[model samples]
Target: MLFQILLTLSIRFFLFDFVLFKSLRNHLKTKGYFFRKLLSCPFCQGFWSGLGVFLATHLIAYNLSFLLPMLSFGFVTAYLSMMTTAIFYPLIDKFEKNYSTL
Candidate 1:
């Protein structure tokens, strides 16, 4: 569980940070409504990434026979991840503001 959270968070931050760095960041975020909504929100990032990680792990490690239970647990995990991302988003913001080359 802990590992899942950390992995999700790390991947979230990487996408929310490094992947979007440089000119492509602003371009993609502004190009389409969908891209804007997806890229600009920490909650969205967290929820999708968190749920994806959970489901992927379940598929890889076990069978999908417990799909309903896994979905419920994954939803809870995603919620937790969403809150955690929101809480950490500002800290990352501060860091970027202080050090960003832009």
Candidate 2:
């Protein structure tokens, strides 16, 4: 049980902090809005984004797993990371703009 929880948390943390966030940073940099902002808070935004992605992916994965029992952890992790990043990109962009002015 503890292992499962830890694994879940680790996956969420890594995906959010590394994959999703790095992608956001790169995209923002490309857009010329690479300012550090306290708007909405990065950690807070990351936590909420991670939690939302975790829940949504779990539900989707559960349903899909029922149909195909070999979905694999890697696929789920990547999918969740991509989904969360896509969802939060716009919000982060807005925050980046806010941060630049300050």
Candidate 3:
């Protein structure tokens, strides 16, 4: 459970912070209404990425039981992890910057 949450959070951060965000904002900038809208906000992209990670982890772990309950739990876990990541993002960014400088 703990590993799943951490994995989901890490995947979400990588997707939103490194991959999807840059690709959407730069290469695909304003190319489409949907892409533009999605690129404009971190939370929106984060939520989807989080949800995807959670669902993927659950599926891989073979933890799926009740459809609705599992879906709900995954979503909740995703959101919480995403939010937790968001809260720590700035601190992590600063640490990375300081480390690179050193």
Best of the candidates, lDDT: 1
lDDT to native, each model = 0.72, 0.48, 0.62
What's the ranking of the predictions by TM-score, best on top? 1, 3, 2
lDDT of 3: 0.62
Point out where model 2 deviates above 4 Å: 1-71
- Candidate 3 collision pairs: none
- Candidate 3 lands at a TM-score of 0.56
Total backbone clashes of candidate 1, pairs 3 or more residues apart or in separate chains: 0
lDDT per residue for candidate 1 within 1-102, as digits (tens), equals 788878887887677666356467678887899889988766667777877887788754455666665666556656766787667768878887888786
Better of 1 and 3 by lDDT: 1
lDDT of 2 by residue, 29-74 (tens): 4554323331223444344444444454554555664434223333
Query: Which tens-of-lDDT digit does each residue in 46-66 have in candidate 3?
Result: 556656766665554444464
Weakest 10 consecutive residues of candidate 2 by summed lDDT = 32-41
